[model samples]
Target: MNKFELVFIPGPGIGHLASTVELANVLVSRDDRLSVTVLAIKLPNDIKTTTERIQSLSASFEGKSIRFIVLPELPFPNQSSEPPPLMLQAFLESHKPHVREIVTNLIHDSNRLVGFVIDMFCTSMINVANEFKVPCYLFYTSNAGFLDFSFHLQELYNQNNSTAEQLQNSNVELALPSFINPIPNKAIPPFLFDKDMAAWFHDNTKRFRSEVKGILINTFVEMEPQIVKWMSNGSSKIPKVYTVGPILQLKSIGVTQSNNALNGADILKWLDDQPPASVVFLCFGSKGSFDEDQVLEIARALERSEVRFLWSLRQPPPKGKFEEPSNYANINDVLPEGFLNRTADIGRVIGWAPQIEILSHPATGGFISHCGWNSTLESVWHGVPMATWPLYAEQQFNAFEMVVELGLAVELTLDYVKDFHIGRSRIVSAEEIESGIRKLMGDSGNEIRKKIKVKGEESRKSMMEGGSSFNSLRHFIDDALTNLQEGNY
Candidate 1:
């Protein structure tokens, strides 16, 4: 039996890199004959911190069947001037030659290269996998619902021969089976509306559904059985898709920054003093932020709801500018007048909170979240129900799935973004935010909590030996081995 190395090409972000590395860890731990090398592309703004975090994760996985090769930072002269999605695309495009070199050397050294696993953003790397006659698998860092929608949206456009302008202009709700509710026209991500971006997404979805060997989603069968079932059985377009996830190896990998001022001990201690399931943990994802007015509205909402809360806030980026983690600032300057003083007993506002550790706290009964896929999984893993407030990306779809399909969350308007370019979303008024807060943390939230608790138990059980997620991993390994032995990859 020969050992195999799977080359993983992760997009430039902590979220993408962490999930991919964790997946690699699980794959190697499950099969002793497997190893992985992550080709990490460094983004211009995140080079320093991303490097440090990856170095830390690499150290923790030391002596294990995992290693990392950080590709040099791409020389993007206009990095400071471009948006993140565009910047990330440019970085990945520039690093192709480097990735090709690494993959070629591994093969030349006679390493049994079983497959090439790529993050969703790095779908273009399928070409590299094809060039070397290796199978390519997409490691989706989000839920199966998002993946299903992306595939369906692509097919919808392809079948209709609809232009992006027509799709954007139409008021038609997408009738996707993955969602119990139809996706509102406005709730659709901007990428699907822009001609060039839609083309890029369609191209990738085409490759993923037809050309890619498999898709590894970061969700469990129990958490999203409907969508998972649809992808595995109902959809003929989607290739073999596996739910080998709730792949949270961040703790084992120790991926957090050690220098954060938000002391985990103090936060946990406060939670310890609170009644069980009494506190609502509020956090947007890493890049999530609100403007000054929005921050004021949030403060007012929290104050009105009178719920015990813990908020980890990042300063809003400048108009039309992107801000990195290193740029996080205190919230006192932007919060409403005397807001901190009034809510002192009810809430703790910090620059950054250790999210995983916080969510695991006993006092955290409800979560007010941006509905980022990572945050959604983390909250579910801890049995915390959510008040879904999505900011951007596929988060709106994730929110819809949680509230409608999965019956796990309360919604804060899915049409929150009225305009993407001008950042002119309908401001979630303080009253509406307060209502959502009350609904999630109050007795009305009991059903949602009950549902999430059951799913959380299922998540834990699925990760155990012979469990759904564990078996899914084993099945994927078996397929890879068969492909290798048959000389089909």
Candidate 2:
């Protein structure tokens, strides 16, 4: 019999691509009869970097049953002005014909195309899956709480007939389900302020969940049980939910320099010099960069905090462009005078530090992160606490849950609009940054460390045989098999 082949469509970024590949790896590893074909989507402005990262991930899976096929980059119509949600929607919508063709050919060849596992951004593939008469599953790359929040917002909007402007501007303290405390408007995603994009996303999520077979979240039940419970309560249109993750195990590259642009030895050597759990690794996600003023303040904060640090800093994005510049300028140009030299003994600054490798190192203790879901999970997996600095997307919600609900991180700032690039004169002051770092690195962080340490153990256990996440995946596979035998596909 032919192996069960599943098609996975990932959104356009390293985080989405990496997590999707990891999930695929888990699927095939769990069952020899399973195989996955990842359909990579190219992002608009950052095509080169994105493709390079995807290629690296594919190479890492060399002997594995997973394969990658990249889709063409979406053509930008008025690319200068379009937001991410709209750009993503356009890309997925425009590529529907291509996806349909691919699926049709696979069916014609009699491949055991059991299901379509698609990224949340690529929900447009649901129609193509329906057309091909296969089950479609949504793979959410973030925490379950973020997923619940999106649906809750949608439900609230629907029930209240609230305008996007009113909802965005309202100082409503919501006691939303799936969370322990009330959620403030400032902790919501900044895109909600954009009336059109917010409406589009809300409607798309509602349709996507209602239309798909189920959702596979990249989270374990132990990490966010409340949120997972809320998601699986069957109140939403999504029929089933699976928590089969903390699934970010990158195959060993075997003693070479890490794939990030920086040298692995240099990063490791610096960490080696520090005491265990003493150094803080700072990195925003792929798209994270700071303005000159914010950069200087970070330098000042690092200097004042007197904590050992490694910063993976980036230049701010070019105007009307979302990608990093091909070349980097000197840090001296942006940092305060004598800041780097004075902190040289305690801090190491580099561009694009190998985040996962560094996080796994014993010398690394805390993370000052953008709270991107991928980073958050990595931090937890390594048993490291975080100083949360959410930049964009659902990161603010992730930070809120980490700090307020899960008790895993310290907050630098939770204001959603403050860190955004659009005409914001306020910079998070050096004093406040220094204070947050001190709190994270000091004895006060002991409880958070203990909590995350237990979580790390639970994360590992969840993937073991008979564990919650392990059983969840097994159940999903069995259900798919039953449906196949019943001719449901």
Candidate 3:
């Protein structure tokens, strides 16, 4: 009998887990020839606030018999603070033994084990696979644009801030339309600006190039063709890359993820009533938090735009009149006061939303987003035009690619320069916001919207029966299994 197994190793957050679990389901649904086990590493003590915080995706992994190898883990910071120093390096050193042991002990017979699927952060797990001499693939849930940016970080020591300055300072141009610099560097996370982040990024890019065997990105071909091309053969010694995604389609297999810990029913119902191309959907990924002033600016801009919208406001809750955003009750009160009253008739402000469902609804015209890769892909899958407000990480790159390269979305007014003393804190004003809204909600966005709708169709096509994503997935399984069957295991 032939068999295959994947070790689902996700990083320290819900986003990673969400992507991992969803992908795992995709792989499983494809055929009975494969099974997967999850290695859920917990963040200790710090997230003891609630059991819910601790097990972000444990319920999804339950009773599958694929085994949940819960490793006793470290405590990461909440929303703020740098990861513990040398986190990537330290995490590798600490988890290497556990990864090796779990493979050796819990996975039962070695003859049955076919391959390892590790997370991007779990590079050390690749080493364990090397020790075991099985093929290993690195899975990243972020956008291909972000991955493309990460791949270039290897040249940062030599590269300048041209990408950053242009994208952030109200300059949006695709450096290479044939290539996907999906988001701009400016909108990337401040971590990329930190000395620590720079160093770690440099090291990881080098490591990924040298060490990994294959790269599995959770995106589709039509979404970022340039990125897919670059990853497949861009740099020296990088592994084969695969683009297979919008894996949310796998939910049809009857695997349901628990609702995220927020309310979004109103957003969904409101969307249900609006006509197609009429309502704008606004959301900052769960990760984005803004000061009250910033929140007010965003809301005022939306109000001024006079567009019907469903805004998911997730700022840290305020206290008294004006409290520091960093000091919040439950992290949901960051919106400016009475601003909702001004737009109450036109907009619905909620604490959290069913973003994918909302995006899929016929009523959602365009999205005002922070451009997290998952959100980016979700919007693309739905053919929704975007007003890109990239807050951090590969968002800037995603924004750039969307507006300039793909011509599917518009990058709204936002400049993020890490440590520039001047103009580093610029917020897109209400007027610019309104204009962007009008563009996406009006005739100006129609052409872009139609193009993206076609692109989204292509994305789905890429994952259909004989499509690129589907074929790549099929080959990954067959190739891994053939290697195992040939006694390479």
Candidate 4:
């Protein structure tokens, strides 16, 4: 009869926030005694869309026990000398006091504060949870494989006392428990090559092992059975992990509010006209975009492949500016001349994709993605096979997992690093893109296509009652209640 409350602190990105909200929704829906209050953080680059998305989510949960509280946005710090990752870390750290204030007021209201479900990047909030004498659970917005890799990397770093330069320079293949084969040096994320970012992740992984009660990963057991088993049974240092996913936002969560609704409608209508399993959908993650040269290569490949396609081509934010990539005012300006007219019969290029809707369509057969964890899960859930083109972050590692470990996707390239710090590591040529498209859409992709279809059904089954993810969610809830009853918090 006692009611319990969980506070969810999501990271700044839309992907992180969306998955966290979905998890919160699931928790509250599973038990009426449970309630969730999401402490939303505004994206640093774009506040308007962030606020609008939060508002939309709040509207969707109207009258539910889930509540959203947008945190006060802080001004960008004057740490120009620091790397962007470190700067973002500091920005999140600055919210500690604000979090403490909100939690204090919640307790004063007689709410039974059970735990703080913080995003992976917001591990610093664990300190705030400790101060309030509540258990902290990390909502890992990524897959278990990535989490396992992080722990392994941290172990290696501590054991060797190695520098970023040393690790990058060495041509060593890491035999990690997460992957079936040894991960080559190039496949490792480029961020690990930077001293500051590597150190930041090292510290974060330590906190994950030593501080949190459990990590609730946005992945299912069937997706990464070996790595999930390794985290739960093989390693003592790893915290208790609950695989309760694929946690996805099936609804359009207001990100597309900025885009024209008619455009979204027309895109879907176009998809309806295509033959079943014919169109290969290409959308990088929200921040995923390319320069003129890369765009031209993709345009050329789409034209050559002659595959029905929907390409979400975004214009990268201006250098040194902290903003989301905007839609091209005239996409033709950056694309090859007459490319649109030439491919008018075979493809359609747009911006700001309605990904879930598109993938759910019968016409969508393949995905060319940036391998962001959310996008990966969505693709799997919808039974659309992917051709991996990882742009940054842990995406390269994710690409490796899909292509090498799970055999669920075709590989375009894994080690493509396109960010302000390093720029494009290498442009994927039109020939390579065309080949990948052929493999994804042609007969070459039949095996992977069949595999993803089965996995998609399994993904859905996992979320149903008595299924793996459902049972995992129940276990997580029971553990939280047990902690409360034992006064462990």
Best by lDDT: 4
Candidate 4 Cα errors over 4 Å, as ranges: 255-262
Identify the leading candidate in terms of TM-score. 4
lDDT of 2 by residue, 342-416 (tens): 987998777766788888999998999989988888899889999888877888888888998888898888763
Task: Give candidate 1's whole-model lDDT.
Answer: 0.80
Model 2: how far is 310 from its true place, Å?
0.5
Work out the TM-score per prediction. 0.94, 0.94, 0.82, 0.97
Shift in Å, residue 126, candidate 2: 0.8
* Candidate 3 segments exceeding 4 Å error: 45-66, 77-85, 88-93, 155-190, 233-236, 249-262, 317-337, 417-424
| Residue 298 alpha-carbon offset, candidate 3, angstroms | 1.4
Candidate 4 residue-wise lDDT, 1-489, digit = tens: 547999999999889889999999999899999989899888566788888888899999998889988889897665455767787788899999988999888887656999999998898899899998999999998889888888888887888765577668648788885568888776788889888789888989989998999989999999998888888884547878999999999988664532323377788898889999999999998899898889989988999888999999899898776567888777768888898789988888888888999999999989999999999999999999999999888898899999998999998887788865666898899999999999999899999999999999999999999899999999999999999999877
Query: Candidate 4 — number of clashing residue pairs?
Result: 0
Ranking by lDDT: 4, 2, 1, 3
Model 2 bad stretches (over 4 Å): 161-163, 235-237, 251-262, 324-327, 416-425
Q: After superposition, how far is residue 330 of candidate 1 from its true place, in Å?
A: 4.2
Q: How many backbone clashes does candidate 1 have?
A: 0
Clashes of each: 0, 0, 14, 0
Q: Can you list the residue pairs that collide in candidate 1? A: none
